[model samples]
Each structure stands twice: as C-alpha cells, then as structure tokens.
Target: MSITLFRTLEMLRHVPREPRKITTSELRDRLAAANFDVTLRTIQRDLQKLSTVFPLISDERDHVFGWSWSRDAQVETLPGMDAATAITFAMAEEYLRDMLPSGVLELLAPHFDQARRVLDATDNGLNTWKRKVRVLPRSQPLIAPDVDPEIAQSVYDALLNDRRLKAVYRPRGREPREYDLSPQGLAFRDAVTYLVASHRDYDNVLMFALHRFLHADVTDEPARHLPGFDFDEWVQRGGFDADRHGEAIQLVAQFDMAVGDHLHETPIADDQHLARTDDDRLELIANVKDTHQLRWWLRGFGPDVEVIEPAEIRDWLIEGARQQISRYADASSGR
Candidate 1:
C-alpha cells in the first residue's frame, strides 16, 4: 500500500468509534468518498499492518470496528504537514545551501526526496509549487574567515552533549586567550558564525566569533547550566542596539533626501525607525552596539550623511573629515 493509504488508515484510527461497527464495504465507500480510489482489500491490508503496531479491535456485539492506542503507547507517527509546509520547506532549502553547516543538508536530502515521492503519489496534483521563487544572496558577500571543520564539529558536539570546551581564541590585534567555556549555542550572524557561551573566567555570557578561534578542544569538564542564562534571551541581546560595552545605546543619524531614499531602500537596522523632516531630510534612529561599523557605513555616504546624536561619534567623524580635507589641501597646493 502507498504511504498515503497508510496515512489515511492512521488518520481513521484516531476517529472516535461510532455506535455501529463499520463494515469493509462501508470503509471502502468512505475511502472512495474521500477520492482515495483504493479497494477495501488494500485498506484491510493497511488495517492489518496497523494492528501489528496499534490496538485494533472489531466487536461483533456492538457491531463496531476501529483502532485505538493505549495512553502509555508511544505512537511513532510522521507529521501531517500540509502542502504549504512542503513549499516552505523547499523555499528554506535554498537558504540552507550556504547558511547551514555543511553535511546537514545531505542528512536532510533523503527526507526531502521521500516527501517529493509521497507528494507525487497523491495523484490530485495539489502539490504544484511556484518554481520561479528565488533568493539571491547579496552580490558582495561578506568576508568569511576560514573555520576549521574539526573545531566546528567539536563545538557542535559539545553543544549537543551539553559539555564544556577549552577554547583558545585570538581576538583581532590581541594575544590569544585560553578559557574553559560552557557551550550554550552556535549562531550565524553578519555573514559569520559565533558561539554564545559562558566562560568560567568571566561571570557573564559572551559572544565569541568562531573565525577568531585559534583552537578548540572538548573537555571532560561538566557544563554548568547557569541560572537565568537563557539562550534565546542571550541571542536577542545581540540585537541592533546592543553595545560593545554591553549597555544599550541609541544611535541617531540624518541623511540628505537622496541618501535617505537609499537608506529607506536598504535598512541598516532590523528595527530602525525612519522619519522625514519638513526640509525633506531623513532622520533615522536605531539601537546599536558597535558604532565603529556604523561609522564606516556612514563614511561611505561622504558628506551626505551626518551623525546627529552621540557627541563622540559626531566628533570622530569631524576629525576624520578634517584629515581627508588636509590630504586634499596638500594635493591642491602642490606642496
């Protein structure tokens, strides 16, 4: 019997028993009524298969025939995911190509293939999906640092087993630091991967870029599932306004109308608030952690973009502009 037939039997097994015992003819008619196009014999074979796994009964006195499961019985059931879920899965597959860790896709490939087969067998042709939908990753890909697969695998294993790790991390322009850390989780962000972990040396949780890791080894050290260290909360804390100093800061900036239009088209913050002034200038406010990255971004706009808030940022930009002007002054003076 087809997987669909098996699924139909499984679904029928859950339906509450009626007063009357449903006969094979009645069951066949029900299947036909639902456009199953299968015979009673096939359904009977399916029922027999289910009987081996579940508690199936036919009562002559009540003239009732149905299947039921005990409360303690572990039902090994597949998800009854609809066509929308399948389409969504297919769409997600495109993003998974580069975003997910390597080898993960291969593990899921067989399941996708099985789903396609089941969809094909349905014969109703209800699984038609738009093949035109595409996701074009940014043309200018972010510079991804080389991550050792063995180290990444080790980190993954530690997170999976709820174990600790000894990580030797080398921050940019800084000496390497070795630490014993509890592997909380791994995440992909800003076109790079990071480990959200808790260091034994530090009382607070930290985000360590995986690329910056010089070496990592799984330790027999037991992981301390700390109090109030929620992974989701920790990840959300790394949002736009999160700070390098771990303090939330407001970032405000103004741009010319033309530059404002570009910013509107491509937002810099996930939750940026944009407003248009009476003079047609665009004002943007966001919560940001690292102003250094934002400074570099605004610099690309030349004089069109201005930092309106955070006196330190404004002063830094002014000094940078002065250095640029000094360079042009010497060129113009031919001295």
Candidate 2:
C-alpha cells in the first residue's frame, strides 16, 4: 500500500479508540489535531466501511450520530491481558506515571487497554481510584521537574543493566560538566527522581537529578560494585536532605499555648518532652539532628515558638529574624 493509504488506515484505527464517544466532525478534528489532515466526510466513510468487521457502533437515535466501540465488546483481541496483569497495569498507569520513561508507558499501551477493560467490567469503580487518592508533599507543593524521555531511558538502562554511563550534568545555573560514573541506585522522593551514582575513579557516592541530565549513555564497562551500599542508611544519614548542615545537636525550644496545642499531636521527636512553665508556655527538648529543616520548622510557627538552644541555633534564628525585619522595614521605606 502507498504510505498515505497506510497512514489513513492507521488513523481509522485511532478514531474509535478515544476514551470517549466522538462524532465524525469531532473525529476529524482529533485527526487534524494529531496532524493527520483528514476530512470529516473521509472519517464518516471510513467508519461506515470499518463498522462491518470492527466492533464499531453509532447512536443513530440521536440527531447527530456519535461513534464508539460496542458496549459489550471485549478488548481481548488487542493483546495479551490476563486479569492480574490488567489490574497491575491499571495501577501502574497512575502510580508509575512520573517514575517510568514515557517510552515504557507507550510500550505498555496494549496493557493499559487490558487494564481499562478489566476495570470497566469489574464495575466497582476501581478505574476512578486516581481521583480518590492523593500523595501530597509534607512541605508546600511545587511543580515537579520535567524529565526527558531518552535521558531517563538511558539512566534506567545503565542502572538496570549494571553498566557505567557518561553523563553531562549541570547543577543549578552552572555550566554542564562531563563525567563517567556507575549508577548505584535510583530513588524517587517528593516528585524528583535521583540517581545515586559514584565517580569512576573514586568510592564517593553522589546523587544526580534525573531531570538535570543533559545527556547520558550506557557504556560497555560494568558498574562498580559497592559491597556495603544501603540506600536507607544513606538516606537516614541525610544524603538526600539539602538542609543537613552542622553536627547533630540537642534542639530545645519553647512554645506558647497556641503552638503547644498544635504540637500535642505532632511532637518534635519520639523522646521529646514538654514541660509547662509559669507563664503557660511549654518548654520542649529533643535530641535531634542539627539541620536547617528543624530551624525552618520552628521559624514557621512565628511568635508561637521560640528556640532556646543550642545557643548557636538560637543565634542563627536571631540573625535571620533581624535580617528579615530590616528587609521589611527597608521595603516599607521604598528601598
């Protein structure tokens, strides 16, 4: 067949596969939007022709006929879709949407159909579960970093195949720098995927943002095997925590009645103790890691909370508040 005729037949298959019903005009519009350049009459005629063998149907009772697959049609003819795999794809389509490469999702499109059919048949509203559940960040929400398809695929390929990679990594506004490394592990946290990898010449493990990879390629060399690498331990050691600064210290703070009321449900730590004072304030003490995240948390409570110790942290907060107050004062004076 000619390429044009082949593409026409391809477009014919897509018309009825939309998630919802479509009129011939709507189908033509979809084709146009997809850069198919087909006419509405052509779509109607193709639908009429394909209806003989396909499970295609049209609502003739309506003033304007709308087309879709037959309600009772089984998607079994499409591909391999066992009940288990179908449900798995249904869940993966949502949960792994941000985790996996887009190419993988496209490769699993047939299974998504299987998932859709199984979900629709079950009728227990499992298909709509995406709307019912939400995974929110503990901090203020922010837009997730955009990941490139080919770059992500290459990263996964290297990590999964236990191969080394040459990557051009750019940090913040810095210029891109090239390096050769072995990917140790992959982690997803707060809408960002990180690559825990080590330098080719050293034992140091550094994390790379998947989105920040300008280029990456799987190399022939095998990845360096680190015998005692543990992702959880690395995380607990604040490998991924940007706020980890200074040594761990005993964090002591005082909270007003309002802040104390809030902390009743969310104590600073498991071993934290709150003692009431004469002025109805509560003093809290906990042995915690001296991280900026803790400082930021206390500062967020504004006047309701006060940092008492270590003296260094309290001094840091005092300096920060002074800077903020001066900045505001300057802004008010039209600086």
| Candidate with maximal TM-score | 2
Tens-place lDDT digits, model 2, residues 41-154: 778887788789777887777687788766445455435565556666777777666655454454456567767777676656565764676654357754457776567767
Report clashes for each candidate as comma-separated counts. 6, 0
Weakest ten-residue segment in model 2 by summed lDDT? 12-21
Q: Pairing residues by index, what is the TM-score of model 1?
A: 0.54
Against the hidden true structure, what lDDT does model 1 obtain? 0.67
Question: Against the true structure, candidate 2 has what lDDT?
Answer: 0.74
Q: Mind giving the per-residue lDDT tens digits that candidate 1 earns over 151-259? A: 6756876898788999899877999999799987777865677787888946577778776787888766777787877877765554323564334567798889886
Clashing pairs in 2: none
